[model samples]
Target: MPVPGFADRWRIEPVGAMRVPGVVFASAALLPQVAEEEALRQVANVATLPGIVEASFAMPDVHWGYGFPIGGVAATDVEDGGIVSPGGVGFDISCGVRLLAAPVTLGEVGAALRRLMDRLGVTIPRGLGSGGVWHLPDAGALRKVLEGGARAAAQAGLGTEADLRRCEDGGVLVGADAAQVGERALARGLHQVGSLGSGNHFLEVQVVEKVDDPTTAAAFGLSASQVCVMIHCGSRGLGHQICSDHVRLMRDAMARYAITVPDAQLACVPVRSPEGRSYLAAMAAAANYGRANRQALTVTTRAAFAEALGTSAGSLQLVYDVSHNLAKLEHHDIGGSERLLCVHRKGATRALPPGHPDLPDDLRPFGQPVLVPGSMGTASYVLTGVVPGEAFASACHGAGRTMSRHAALRHVRGAELCRRLEASGIAVRASSLRGLAEEAPEAYKDIYEVVATCERAGLARRVARLRPIGVVKG
Candidate 1:
């Protein structure tokens, strides 16, 4: 078959034993951006993996990454000798986004914005090696968190069962094995729960400006003029360590299996292999830690909002939580056959269509809520998964970065950026001025464009738009 074409920006061709053609999603304007070639090359590289059932795909935000491109998505059949690559999951296991709708409105908190930002800045740890209020847990308790996920956090008084119901996978993935995790990984994660780590991670207070889908908005308990909180974070050092540990292990296993690929970073073992199973187990454990971490942050956020607004936690409700990183066990139809497959999503959000059994019952009518956060000074969006020709029911994760942090620092100043944001009525706080420069609004692609593309591509539908009132970064 002639290579599938996607505008002038993408060139897709079949390679190796790929059961389907590769699909690259981008536009003419983005073609030059992808000219670097690594991401598209990685797309082809992914096709060479054993048992890959469908087209190895890349979103418009695709960029060169460790193993898979940052926006890469792939699914493999386990029974057909599929393999799992740690690089496909990325280091930030379960790096996700959470949006909470508050009972208070923007008008109520507009004047106290500075105070709220200050309080959040002081309370939340940021920057490198920053610590939070939570004490490090022992290996035994940590293991429980790895296995039980958000439930473990709620039992420990971090949140309630209701929080889990609003979270993806109920905030836990089965088969997590703490024993497979290393001591160093646990140590790095112990004190990091509830802490907001650096690099594209943030917590922002926002106001709902527009509700595009009234019915879905009502189902998600969101309304125009309502205030909300958006938290973007990940598994922290623990997840990083898990990826590092497995990358090295997989490299060694590759040698034993005599596997050769275009890139060493794509090193992997059969999903049924001892090494692969152990990596998945440890990865799940770290992912659980991430879910627990976000849950803990939710508790803190509720407290802050309650204290700032003189309200109660009972009135603060969670909207939804979804992770963009990490691999999942899912069943999808391939060539008209329903088969169990391991779907790896890096910098890609799960956009399950309506009536999926995995979605929260209340949200089933609305489909899975997809939160796409922009840079601090930009607008975020609330979206829902739509059913069509979904490769794996996935969507874009964020206003994907357009420039490197170092490049951003070279062009922007912290003070100037801060002043511009404040002038626009958005409060800003950060652990470091240098860190602030790295996240300059110009560093990222226009989220508005990204969301539009997602809609045009039939991946998701926009439900609401959010404007930031205050942002806390670390």
Candidate 2:
């Protein structure tokens, strides 16, 4: 089948057992880099999944991942023998970004920037092991986090109701069943709530450098020179254990149902099957854990600011909290009829358009805020969904990795990279120099190009640009 380009996207016609076609959103400039990896083939493999609707799609930042490409998006008709794959959601579960806009501006916080970052670095628990802002006293306390997410944390005095109102699914993914979570997963999660895991996760202090759409930016509580905190993390060990367990379960159960897939990593079962329901329930619980983890970090961050700059926690208002991973059951129009579908978005952000009922009342007219974090030391962007959106209203999550950690370590030393970042006036705090080397800015694609492709493809629109002034690396 011939691959053809249309506007900012390319179409790959289905062949063999593919149930649908494949669509990749990218500019000609990005095609070369994207083609350099195995992501395109993965996109084609994803099309062969049972009950897939429309076309398997890849965002501009698409890159090689375990099963589906990291930037992949696909929806399966739930009523039509649709299957849910753990690979589609990745191991992070609800690994996503949260943006908090502070009332202070860069000018007001300039003098104390170093002190504030130092305070945050110490207060924020990070790295591989296990430690967090809030330690659950027992399994019972942990259940509250798994079941209630950030909302439960708010009830425990970690945050406010207003914060939950700004979160996706109100900070708790409905239908989560704590009982579905395994003992090992529970133990791993107990002490890890609110920790920033190693490898690409971070807590950044940024300043709004520019506003592309003044009205929408204002609606999102963002303005030029305003300070913000961007957190990129997930459910930590709990989510990973769940994915590992479910993937193994599904792989073993597929044979009984006589279902075959192109890749074993794409292990799946019918959405209505026993194993399938179990995974979804456990996944939701982990997602809630992820949200609560971020909320705990928010509390610590606010307290750090108060101690450093005398600003109250209330000064930091959540602009939005959205997840980029997980398979969600949502109602969408297909063939002119509303259908329940399992939408899987791995390393991709959901960009719901304006007027969507799911949006908060205050943000309904502006659309959902899509937080796109850039590679360390690079500029991040805030984008909004547009009408007639494609790929189920999804957009790129980050500047996709271009080089592996080993390759990046061979290319640049962590000490040199830290020096360069500090020289540019960006403060650096990392658990280890080697960890910093793995995330050198050169390890990823150009974030500006990726965001431009998303806008050009009409997946989302730019609202504001954020420049990192300080970062806490795990």
Candidate 3:
């Protein structure tokens, strides 16, 4: 039986071949919901993985997901038999959120809100099979995007260097290997840039509602009632294919490597193994694809906002672009010794603390921006990363789903929900009513409570709260 209530976080002692303890971060109110779900079991299952160093950790928004919990985080020493799993990263590689602040106030765009949503809905391709928004000129151009990510997009005049610097890894993984990208994946992702893929993905126009830390908010170029655009997407079909292809390889070759897991979905190979090296290179490429995809969408969004509001494109300044599903080689101090490890965050976001070398010069005094999106038509929070004391510098990705998509459909109708949103002063545009119904806000945990728990857990501190004025779902 699970422990009663959440106490900062609960600890699961190693049992049945477990390599480490399982730790869950939640509040008393959230513990019962978490305990009733299968995510806790998944958390424990992760503890049995190869060379796991720290505890297998889950954030407050944890829910049952593929192999690992939705908000799972783990690190294994690369020099000590660490391995990388496609399951640990998820199918939508580098799925992340980008926040861009518009110089205009919400009051300024109040009357034009409906028109703006209409324009964005028409101009931005979304839903399944959505593509051709990035204008890839040739196969060579596709390779460049897969390799350089948003940096390449900026070079092509989509954004500026300032925007690139504000992004994680400068919006590019410099080590991406295009050669490792499979042809099928290439074909699938060639033109999908600037598209919002289906299921929980969205493009929203928001207004900053409240600021918890005015100093940090100002640094992020945010003010109360300021308009902003938030984009949630990933590498699309290409990342999915890469994960599928690599998972098959690792699963089949596990016996040869003398590796076995409680679950086949946790398939992995050593970080330095030929297969692992190949996956890393390929994963980096897919992640780059995700970065490039979001960057392209940023370009489209800027144009759409500018055209609708009669403001210059430069008025919409990028706040941050951060990836979630990724396994990166990083250095973390473990037991008085700094060691290099492969950190896997499946449905989590990096919350780099202040003074971290990875942060840009301007943001160094503060910390990394952590965008935690809520359910559709709900409130989202912008947080500043703290020291990342015990959670491996990670935080919850979103208001994790409490009910499944099927469950959501039974609870609400998409058309009715849209009407309610509009009545509540929010605009809704979606390609699929079914998709919209599946993403109903009631299907997920209360974001305000989740964020409150995260703040209490010392993972990150809230900076600003944003409420959606208009939303476009895929």
**Best candidate, lDDT-wise?**
2
Candidate 1 lDDT over residue span 1-474, tens digit each: 223443322446775644556776665566566656577778888878877876887776677777788888898898888888888899999999999998877776767667667767777777788775556457787788889888898888888878889989888889999999998998888878888898789999899999999999989989998989999999999999999999998988887766666678788888888998999999899889888888888888877776666665226688898989988888998879998888989988999998888888899867999899987789999999998536599888887777888899999999889888889999888777788889998987778877877786778899999999888987
Model 2: per-residue lDDT, tens digit, 218-243? 99999999999999999999999999
> What's the lDDT of the predicted structure labeled candidate 1?
0.83
CA lDDT of every candidate: 0.83, 0.93, 0.89
- Per-residue lDDT of model 3, residues 353-451, tens digit only: 988999998998899999999998999999989975557899989999999899999999999999999999999999988899999999999898899
Q: Which candidate ranks first by TM-score, i.e. highest?
A: 2
Worst 10 residues of 1 by lDDT: 1-10
In Å, residue 355's CA in model 2 sits off its true spot by 0.3
Clash totals, every prediction: 0, 0, 0
**Which order, best to worst by TM-score?**
2, 3, 1
| Model 3 regions lying over 4 Å from their true place | 1-7
- What's the CA error at residue 294 for candidate 2, in Å? 0.5
